[model samples]
Target chain A: MTTIADPKAPRPPKPRPARLTTRGNTELYGWVFMRASGVVLLVLIFGHLFVNLVAGEGVTAIDFGFVAGKWASPFWQVWDLLMLWLAMIHGTNGVRTIINDYAERDGVRLALKSALYLAFVLVVVLGTLVIFTFDPCPSGSPADLLPSFCTA
Target chain B: MPDALPASATRKVPAGTLYRGREGMWSWVAHRVTGVAIFFFLLVHVLDTSLVRISPEAYNDVIATYKNPIMGLGEAGLVAAIVFHAYNGIRIILVDFWSKGPKYQRVMLWVVMGLFVVTMAGFLPRHLMHVFGGE
Candidate 1:
């Protein structure tokens, strides 16, 4: 019996030595970010959940006053600041990977990434400002709605 | 798996669209769009919440401002932003680390969309009620 062979067939080539370049290695750096950020996110996110939800009186204990109490100290403020920065960087890098994969045109990719970077800067700056500048106990706040600690 | 095209085979083809540089595959593109949206939301949210630290009057003023119809809509937009950012972040994590990541991008996309819909559907009603207040 004769067997039929397919037309338009491809024959595989023997492997050749791979070239290494800075550009080729830059991709390695991005891959590193995915792993590194994933690890850090695991810690930062879980720590946030633990402090906000599990510590003290649990979920019911959270409210405006609770938030005010935490921000009353610089330590909690810095803790939250670190969390914000890490999560934003982690989340942004993850999305940047996605954009490069799907955005077909150079112009489209440039536009999208430019927008992403701008927004990232804006948030990080604004969030850091808020955390550092926050004054949870303003003297002039209304006695009724203000946290009790504010009056003292 | 065509053998490396002979120079002769490639030479005669009319130029198709010039290949763009910095080609991102697919998932990276989605990741970026969600990242930017979430970042913008974070900026506004932090700024708004920061008012609470200024004074109770200022905080109440900001909250009351959000009750305005346009601001109410903006809050809903924020909910959407967070949902997309979180869902896409999870997708990236799964794809990069797990053996199944490459295989599951399409399914993950659908899952993200579905969760986005459900989250907004649940969140918007409560938000609207808060903004509009009871009859």
Candidate 2:
């Protein structure tokens, strides 16, 4: 004969104690870095935008000459360099979090994260190089192709 | 006596319980929203800026499209999202690391909001001036 449980019975013990999955404080630091970088990025990003798109003649004013003019100043160079590095790293970490949450298979997660990290490094390196190494007035270029300032 | 059914199988969470608009819950939601927004913006921004390498005229032409008044308004919204996300993100970090953080999370959130307001107050006027000021 089957016996039914009483409604007034006490609860049973849990299966096992929960163990932490994350190692040391790495994830903790990652969490903190997200916040710190985010704060800095707001300033860097907005300043870059204001100067580029709104200052002077607004977006229509942006061109090779405009960028060359801005980068000519060491201030804008550093401003842009900080913005590029912080944003890329912050964004990569954010996506890593997303992948951890959504990706079920370990192999898939590893592959995706590896690809993401590779893209992060590629873009950051290339963008940094472009910002610093850009030459508005290269010798031997067709005069017609260069910005007016280069000739002046 | 027969064993009782597992709590997971028998218990039901009410819809209201799931939908309760707690402060921490909303903060998490905003974080995800802002993170995604910035990620997408970065993709388009990088692609557009890379146009500079192709030709100056191409880069300038692409950037010219951003001059629309409508886009200016959108930029304001984007700034607000970034500010909130950044401020709240700091609060989250504190809660994870600070000794007294979990106990004072609500207080920290207000502090973050206050800082956000101050920062926006300083930046918005200049930004608005530039946006509305004629070329």
Give the TM-score of each candidate.
0.57, 0.71
| Model 2 segments more than 4 A misplaced | A1-29, A39-43, A53-61, A105-115, A138-149, B1-20, B93-101, B114-135
For residues A8-80, write the lDDT of model 1, one tens digit per residue.
6776677865854454576787677666665665566546645753455543344456668788877788778
Tell me how large the interface RMSD of candidate 1 is: 5.8
lDDT of 1 at A99: 85
For model 2, residues A75-98, the per-residue Cα lDDT tens digits are: 887988888889999999998999
Docking quality (DockQ) of candidate 2: 0.29
Candidate 1 stretches greater than 4 Å from native:
A1-20, A23-70, A73-79, A91-126, B1-30, B50-59
Who wins the lDDT comparison?
2
Q: Scoring each candidate complex against the real one, what DockQ results?
A: 0.16, 0.29
Assess chain B of each prediction and give its TM-score.
0.69, 0.83
